[model samples]
Target: MKFGLSLLFIIGFVAIHLLSRRMKFVRMVPRSRFLSIVGGISVAYVFLHLLPELGEYQEHLYGDIGNAFWSFLEHHIYLISMLGLAFFYGLEKIVKHSKRKNSKKTKSSTGIFWLHIGSFTIYNSIIGYLMIREEFSGAWGMFFFFVAMGVHFITNDKGLWEIHKEDYEKYGRWLLAVSIIAGWGIGAISEVNELIISFLVAFISGGIILNVMKEELPEERESSFTAFFIGLFTYSILLLLL
Candidate 1:
């Protein structure tokens, strides 16, 4: 089931990017509101589902580890979460600065654009890899996971397009698309320590929170309260009911 679903997700991920950026109808959709809804759903998943699961994974971390390190590990996932957020925040700043310096040119420097691609390749890869590591309790679990991530990837790709324009089209987008497949292959074949998986998840959650807000919350972006509220409550209700 997972093998089939993961393959579907990889294809869907690429298709969404194309539709969101290239299709006129999709481009006509209110992006701010759409992304806000996505942000809300992603946050719901983090708060309602992922965080609780992290607590369970924390328990599994105990074995022969000393008390101090165990204690540190317990408390430090949150800190690692903060680090993930900060890392992306700083990277975005650097990429933007690099882009600005080359704004007069047709494309940014290859070095600058590669930096952007490299960071987001890692980001997209994490989503693909997590498709395998995430334990979905039922069909709905997988559904929400796909929905949130599919929307999240669309939002992230839109942000990249805004920043890089043709440069992203020429170089970054295909690299990111390929990274998703690569990460899925790696996740399928390789097994990591569960504790490490937990940490990576926590970190990714933090990154998601930061990235979603960066795109959705800006004053320049006009957001639809109706759509945003619908997204929040609908996902919240699903989490509670299911």
Candidate 2:
């Protein structure tokens, strides 16, 4: 049953990527407004669902929490969360650094292009892996996860395309699309401990928060408050009802 459901999602995931790349609707929407809505929905998921879910798992993973190893492990999860955010931010910094260092000598930096592709490949793989592992109770839960993540993946694809342009078109998107399937395959076959799964989810929560904010909060982006609030409230309500 799990495999069947996952296969459906994998198909959906691939279709979404293809559509987001080619669809005029995605391009027609104001970039900032669309991103604002997506980002707001992402934030709602993190705060309303993801973090609370992680908290529920904490007791199971940490046990009494008085033991040194338990304490250390708990700390490690939080640290990993922060590290996920920092890692992505550092990747951006590195790309910018490369761009600056090579700007005068060349119009395009090959090093920066590859770096961007490599980083996003890992990011997409992580997202795809997590998709297979996401625990949901029923059709509604699965649907919710699918919608939230489908939109999130579109945002990530656009972000990469904007940054890498020709490189993303030539190499990045296809690799990323394949990585999603690969991740799902790996996740289906793998048996990870619950504690490890908890930590991975926590880390992803942080990365999602950071990535959404990076898109929505930039001054130049000019995000739409109304659109953002609508997405926030709508998803928040669904989560509450669920």
Encode model 2's per-residue lDDT on 1-242: one tens digit a residue: 76788779878888776667775555423465676788778889888888888877776766546677657766456676778788778877887687677766432377777877777666666667777777876767777777787788888888777666677778777887887788788888896777767877777787888888777767667678888889999999989999
Give the residue spans of candidate 2 off by over 4 A. 27-32, 64-71, 102-108
lDDT of 1 by residue, 91-125 (tens): 87887788789878765567867787798898888
Superposed by TM-score, candidate 2 places the C-alpha of residue 142 at a distance from the truth, in angstroms, of: 1.8
Pull out the clashing pairs in model 1: none
Cα displacement (angstroms), candidate 1, residue 63, comes to 4.3
Best by lDDT: 1
lDDT of each: 0.77, 0.75
Error of 1 at 169 (Å): 1.1
Task: Give the TM-scores of the predictions, in the order they appear.
Answer: 0.89, 0.87
> In model 2, what lDDT does residue 197 have?
75
